[model samples]
Target: MTADTTGVNATTKGADAIDEAIAKGIDFDGTPIPTAKLELYTKVMALEANRQRSGVSNTMRSRIVRIGAKHIPQAELDQLLTDAGFAPLKEKEIAFFYGGK
Candidate 1:
């Protein structure tokens, strides 16, 4: 039997990879992304794009806190924010993001 050379088991992981997959109309798992889901995502993103402006830094901080908390320890994340010239976490953020830990 010939070796399987389709690269079926090879996968790239990360946000860029996911985005590329989405742009190609495929899911990371190699399945087609349903048109309904794509349509809903596009609609919601359109709404977000037109939403009233908050400061760019505020938006950046929100995303960092939201996504960084999942991957970095609380103290490390706080230090990272400070080093990156962003505000360190506030007590409320600490309570919200690291409360369960």
Candidate 2:
């Protein structure tokens, strides 16, 4: 799964973007975060949001975050996803409050 310069999901193109931007130091808009970084965060947040919509458990959510954190700085990544509109909630705490499925 990948996206192109137009932000349309096209694995090779997106990978190319990552390689071009991050690996090669290409710049499109003078944005602080590279194009690849933005795309990476966007996709990760979207996936997490989809998982939430599907009712993935708190344990599962934490696992997902942990996995993501391995790829990038955890605290910054967490804030980035939260700011992008992914609901920040604890799956385990949710279970405690409302019970689990």
Counting clashing residue pairs in each candidate, in order, gives 0, 3
RMSD of each: 4.7, 14.1
Show the colliding residue pairs in model 1: none
Consecutive 10-residue window with the lowest summed lDDT within model 2? 1-10
**Per-residue lDDT of 38-80 in model 1, one digit per residue for the tens?**
8898889889989997899999999999999999999999999
Model 1, residue 88: displacement in angstroms?
2.2
User: 101, model 1: CA deviation in Å?
Assistant: 2.8
- Judged by lDDT, which candidate is best? 1
The models' CA-based lDDT, in order, is 0.82, 0.51
| Candidate 1 regions with alpha-carbon error over 4 angstroms | 1-11
Best prediction by TM-score: 1
